[model samples]
Target: MAVLKLSGTLNSEPQGKSHPEAGSDSSLSFLHGTKLAYASNLVRDWHADLLHYQGLKPGSAKLHRDNLLRLLNHARVAPWELQKDHVTRYFESRVNQETGQMLAPATVGTYCAAWRGFQNYMLTAERVNELFSEFNVRPKAFVDDDNSIAVKRHKLNWVPKGWALTDLEIDAIDETFRSEIARAAREHSKSLLPLLRDRVMFHVGIHFALRISELTELRVSSFCASLDADLQHFGKWGVLTVTGKGDVTGSVPMRDPSVHGLIEWYTNSVRQKILLRRKSKTEDDGRREIKGQMVSVSDLMFPSERGGVVCPNGFRKRLADIAMKSGVLRRKLTPHTLRHTGCTLMVPLYSPEIAQKYMRHKHLHTTLYYYHPTPLGAANEVNSAAQLFDDEEED
Candidate 1:
């Protein structure tokens, strides 16, 4: 039993007595007979649900567990005793220790989501009320709209310069990468391989408008180098297919000759050298069982130095370095920034329907919101409408 303090609160610290009758886990033996221990067990059960029911992979589920643990540790209170204010204060107080900057709204929103999911599970799970009865504390919803930063629409305004790059910016990046590659090749520098890999990732990621997750998930066989010559415009284009979020598969035609050639060179020479260096045995056509279904899995297109999928953090950092060298305004180049650039560039060339399909979005609204953010307001629309009348008068 927990000892009630003079302030009418139970001390969250573990008692000196052990509970052998409860359970015997040597690592957590010190936490036995404490509310913290009970809360930890609840988190373990929640982690299992996240895997079996929510279909989240182990790493993702562990992230949720870690987030909750931070709260439990900070609050120093039992799980059922947690209130909305406790949750709100935790998020509000979050800051980047190194930079001394507050947490991003999007990141705060993700933490809110994890809390909401766990709270929901706590309220509905069988015998949860009975478990809480011992502590005489009723479980309540911890996260609500009052503290949540969740928004239905993208907050592109958060980044004043904007997430998407203009046409000039895109051209500048490409030209800079090309110039750097030429210089490195001429000098026979050791950095050529990494430069080539980053260039391929940039070009392919932008053209495909792929999420960082999708880009990293790409396999060696994801690219189809040839298409039927009888297929008109698509004939000369290669295909880059990826399995995106929610297991939805989509393929986009690779049209840029420069991008196509980069893919070929990287695959034929660079990737082979990486594999040879690591002596990695990952096959192009490997199979794995997922959700009781046999699905094809293979070696990653952009493997790490040790021969695994390239870390997204490392990828982002390298891209940021490239952007810095290119003298781009926004040196932090997230994969979504490239996605926005690709989608924006495609908006004029393709119809909304086509753009939606290419973006692999279930709804046309998503495509429009991402690609057609009207930062300039109706000025462009007004000019275009006026041009129509000018053309008619000339005719």
Candidate 2:
């Protein structure tokens, strides 16, 4: 990878406090200028290492380098002055300068990955490590699972608060949505089909504990029933063979009567009506351009207003809108909230082992960490502790 060659005058006085370089490391201190020459050099070197040593493709290396530069530019600090606070601030800023909408979780996750990769390279590269040591500065991995959305379901939940929807909230949402659908039908509104589609999508997502991408990417063919007796846990309720993160395809068994029934209503009644409307509006044969590729909207379980795959952002907004309209759990609830809520409810209805299997998590700890020890479980634990004390006193 070619280095970012720039011609600019270096600032004599650095913005940050000066670290007294001992002996030979003093020579490298000059590189830390107010123009961020040090950061530029670090990124350029990391890009080359990614290409030559890590065997990353040229395009991939360039992307990593570009993302790193964006972060560095936003911070306006040299490598030594960089901190986790800078990263937090960068992510909190809007992606669109005019609209002022926060960066998407996926986009922030990508940038966080690039930052981690650069930090790892800095620690491993002998010369780079030595260069930082001489200046009394250490490269630290700031963006981690604790802060980044890549590992945590929501960026807002970095502090590990309760975001799962309660049973009462879920019921309120269902009632409100059903009422809205009934109202639309009574008035002969065009929104009736779309409302039904949204309702079905929401019910299926919460019941199945599906990620946003999995929910949006669902197709008619993805649903399967009549598996061998030994293969299914939910019997005739069927399973969803979805391509999840890392392109790992797995079967998510659906047992909820309401979920499967809602899906049936959508596929049999609502889906066909939407496709008919799409066919009338556009002469094209149910195929349209989506992100550069032509896709048949008729196959998608949850097609958008434009008869394409549902946009994740739009789906999130609709969920938020539903909560707001219902006046229940009016906090910022994303699609992942449903996943958390489902997993939370699962631990009580079934064992943690079953919940882990149902979630398809690689480790049992993940299931425990996110959704174990429900309110009832915690209370039971306290009661058990009290019983133990009582027994000890009696002895």
Candidate 3:
């Protein structure tokens, strides 16, 4: 019997000496003298099949293996011996562990999907008998209306109360970034690059209502100016094309002249300064050569100190710091908060339909969630109605 080694480390190994039937491989020692040994091997084979036949990525295959392993261990049964009752009991136990709180539908669905995939694989491979063929394990329906079984619907009009920034708060945030930029420029600080970059990020994020992922993944190619038929130069009015959720690509018009100027200045001056500094540092260190591909200014919209893609966590932490400095509650400020602020302002400034288009939301309902009516809007409506009544009295 050839022992198969699975990728990633196992949590625990089987106790005592390895069985002769289990072979001499150390990786297979974890399965020695256990009922799960053969089942584990089958899972390893299934992982390979997923990679080779199903064309799944290694990370995805690992997730499948992890999910399947949990089920097998909980049931303590071979693939052929797995019954619907055993699977149901496992799910019930998991639910009970939550102490009366309902498990997320997605969480339960993943468990069911992993089990179903493993069972189907076994059936196809002729490893399991017909008894296990009809085993059906699935998550119960978790719908908002308590009616739909297949899908869970979230409240479309749900937005956190007081999530959007007020005019004063927005001004404070803008001032904080501007102050940082000024300080760095005056001091000729090494932090100048990051200050400039973050300021641009803030403007872009708020203006476009971009998700953090979309904002961070932006490249030089994503932004274009009207004057530059090519991406060679930045113009007064710029357009940014972003790939948002659901793989939908949309063009966001940077109508704010100040935002366009900030981006243009950063691209032409501050970005090059940072890149040059990195290059000089790399040369002085003589450690490892910086790759030619990484030296391009157009590669990433925001590069790290080491000239790599900026981590999303880093972006969040920087934003948090800026928010705190601006005297805003750190918890209240997030990338999404900026997005909400953009959408909130859009409703009053333009229209709900325009907000939907600007935010690139799939549904108008999603846009409606962020449309917070201002007091001024309400007062204006009242005044308009009152004027109409007064005119009627005169007539």
lDDT of each: 0.66, 0.68, 0.62
Worst 10 residues of 3 by lDDT: 1-10
| Local lDDT at 318 for model 3 | 80
Q: What is the per-residue lDDT of model 1 for residues 70-104, given as tens digits with 9 covering 90 to 100?
A: 66656656666779888777755554445566555
- The local distance difference test score of model 3 is 0.62
The order by descending TM-score is 2, 3, 1
lDDT of 1 at 328: 64
lDDT of 3 by residue, 1-395 (tens): 11122222232245574531121122332334543466567778898988889877676777777766655566565555666666565555544322454445556555566666776787653454333443332222211222222123322332355467777787888899889879988999877788788878887788778888877766777766655455324463367787777557777666566777777787787777665565435344422222222334446777666665566788888888888988865455778777887777666566566667778876765666565545566345323222322322110
Task: Please list all clashing residue pairs in model 3, or write none if there are none.
Answer: none
Off by over 4 Å in 2: 1-158, 226-237, 246-248, 279-283, 289-294, 311-314, 348-369, 372-374, 377-395
Model 2: which ten-residue window has the lowest total lDDT?
Answer: 3-12
The superposed Cα distance between candidate 2 and the true structure at residue 151, in angstroms, equals: 14
Off by over 4 Å in 3: 1-90, 96-102, 105-162, 225-237, 279-295, 328-331, 348-350, 373-395
What TM-score would each prediction reach against the true structure? Answer: 0.55, 0.58, 0.57
> Candidates 1 and 2: which is better by lDDT?
2
RMSD of each: 10.4, 11.3, 11.2
Give residue 168's error in model 1 in angstroms: 3.6
True-vs-predicted CA distance for residue 241, candidate 3, Å: 0.8
